[model samples]
Target: MRKKTNSAIRRWMYAMAYTAVSAVVLAGCGNGGNEPAAGDGKLTVTATTGMIADAAAEVGGEHAEVTGLMGSGVDPHLYKASQGDIKKLDNADIIFYNGLHLEGKMAEMFEKMEDKKPTVAVARDLPESALRTDPSGAHDPHIWFDVENWISATEVIRDTFIEKDPANEGDYRAQADAYIAELKKLDDYAAEQIASIPEASRVLVTAHDAFGYFGDAYGIKVMGLQGISTASEYGSKDVSALRDFLVQNQIKAVFVESSVPKKSIEAVIEGASKMGHEVAIGGELFSDALGKAGTSEGTYIGMVKHNVDTIVSALK
Candidate 1:
């Protein structure tokens, strides 16, 4: 049995965050309009997740001191800020986050900081037509799954850095152009690799629906036990339904996300087995977060390549 639903974890985090935010609001405690640069005069930036942090580093180049709040395999949806994280945010000259409610528990805190700091949501300004929405019409915050969307986000980060530190505008623009060109190549690579999978077997089932953008971009049909947000529940009915899907389509493998528990996917595998469909665990994917700081999958391009290669190997 699953120990706890992602929704349960998120709810608990939200309560704790609400209490913390309330106290902070009451005391009016936060960094008050300090644009203090880093030790070497670079802007100090704090991002909510590894992906956004990577963007800052790529666009800011040596002009920003970047820090990420969430580490490898950390789920952003349910993550709550610690005292240490609050300190980082307070000291940062600017903050970047995925937005679209991706950081469910910390949205309020980010909102509070918008006025005091150059807090930007990289994906929030994207055209709605480019975004996928949930059944309830909320924009899906997993924009990083699509390489092109990620390129757009990188540009957003670049623009924000330029706006914050106009003196480094030339460096930021140059870096942004280089990174964008690299992402274009990455997009082609992903498409080529995904095309290697047989059309009939191009169905990607994972622990959650974080890969919708990937599927849309690469022509794969994505299915997940939970909804767009891991905060959604997956009951026995969901499991049985997904099991039937696997059996019907003769799916050979399902994937597990780094940031989501494998228990839900394991249950799906077990359910498929009972119905006579032998499915394998394809590979671990970086969904809501990236890999370790020094690893290959630590960078956005590398992470996407690893995921594409893993999917192609399992499904081809």
Candidate 2:
């Protein structure tokens, strides 16, 4: 299966290469209509994920035209950029992405583009002391799970924009300040909401280990069927082990992530049920991506609030 998947990806890459070249040539011919022309007074910023795009849009305000490549329920770890995305990246005045290998398949491409454009990894410059390491000793890429950490990422975006477009530094700073205050409120709300779950039941189980930072911030115990990245697969033994843990601890609920398949969680549910436990799917959580655009869950603050509300309602 892995081999077949890889082969398919290779074919896709080959196909995209042809499309990418044509896109670049076409873009050059028309000055890249996707981006604002020079003297249009707006910076063209492209972000890798919806969360990053939200931050850019809020901070950049009227000074930037922001575009995100991956949208709701999109998994960055396995995502491969399409030719159109390459064109957008090529024309962007600034590009922001969550680093620390979050966009695993696209990391190499970003590295290559760094010298060609103002590409910044919002999470990469964070103090190592503040980062959590996975079992493989790599920093966990889901830093947005912690509202405070996400605020730091926004600051990084603000700084990057200031450096790239100095004329709009003041605007960026003002918007960032406002956004930071709102994020503080969001952080407080998440803490208050999660606090409602009884201490004995203050445990979160999800499709993958994307909530380590969240659990750390809110004092909840989190378990995941798979590893930090959805790229990791769980076998029958892994499911059985989790089932035993749930059965012994009387954990009543587990969650499905927006970007990950529910099969593993379903398997665990079945395993626990067969063992005479009645475990339920607490709710769906936006782990790796936000909800659709224009919806409340589409925004970062709204996404966090939705997640906490879902968790509290189910586990309380």
Candidate 3:
């Protein structure tokens, strides 16, 4: 069962209000007056997620200094901007976010920052035809799971840097091209690894619907006990249903996310066990965030590789 629904909602509302008021007050305090000149030093970039921060750093190379607001094991869906985060957003020369309501509570804050600086939603401009929608028609915001989609996001970051700091356009172009090539290779690696999994075992069950894009990209079936956003709640019924699905499909394992609590999946496992189906917990996957900084799973490419390797090892 989910926890703290009412408290979480209240916190989100308070944060949203605070962000809106802070943006207005900060706007009046000459927050955007200190725009960094081209070649002035390093461009200051603030990104909402580690994935975007990784892309900004890779594409910007030595020409930019990037800070990710959400770190390892942080869930953006329920994230509320702190006063410190507000200061960072106010001071950054440019900001990049996943958008598509992934950072739902921070929407107004980003909207307010648009006039102050270059606030780009990397995933917002992806062709709608390439996006997946929930039953209520909301586009899924976890586009980073699809390496091909993330390549487009990398291009968006690269283009933003070029436009903002034309003095280093050549460097940005080169860095972005190299990174995109790596992403293409990563995508191929995921496809090949997933293909190795036995057809009957090519199923991915997780704490939430975060891997829809991964399943779509790799030709695997995915089931989640919760909805796309971690803010969405699940009940005993949902767990029972997922347990039934696993037993009927004879799935060997269900993965846990680094950012989500493990108890939900554990409940499903317990339920399955009661019905005589034995299921194991696959290795943790980096879902809403990356691994600890400086680790193999810290970078975007490394995170995708880690997830793919874990899935294949467990399900194959």
Cα lDDT tens digits for candidate 2, 34-60: 334488778888899999999999999
Structural similarity to truth (TM-score) of each candidate:
0.90, 0.90, 0.91
Clashing pairs in 2: none
- Each candidate's lDDT (Cα)? 0.87, 0.88, 0.90
Best by TM-score: 3
Clash numbers, per candidate: 0, 0, 0
> Which one wins by lDDT: 2 or 3?
3
CA deviation > 4 Å runs, candidate 2: 1-39
Among all windows of 10 consecutive residues in model 2, the one with the lowest summed lDDT is 28-37
- lDDT by residue for model 3 (148-253), tens: 9999999999889988888889999999999999999999999999999988889999999999999999999999999999999999899989999999988889
Return the lDDT, model 1, position 132: 96
**Candidate 1 Cα RMSD after full superposition onto the native fold (Å):** 5.5
All-Cα superposition RMSD per candidate: 5.5, 4.5, 5.0
Task: Check candidate 1 and list the clashing pairs.
Answer: none
Instruction: Write down the worst ten-residue block by lDDT for model 1.
Output: 26-35
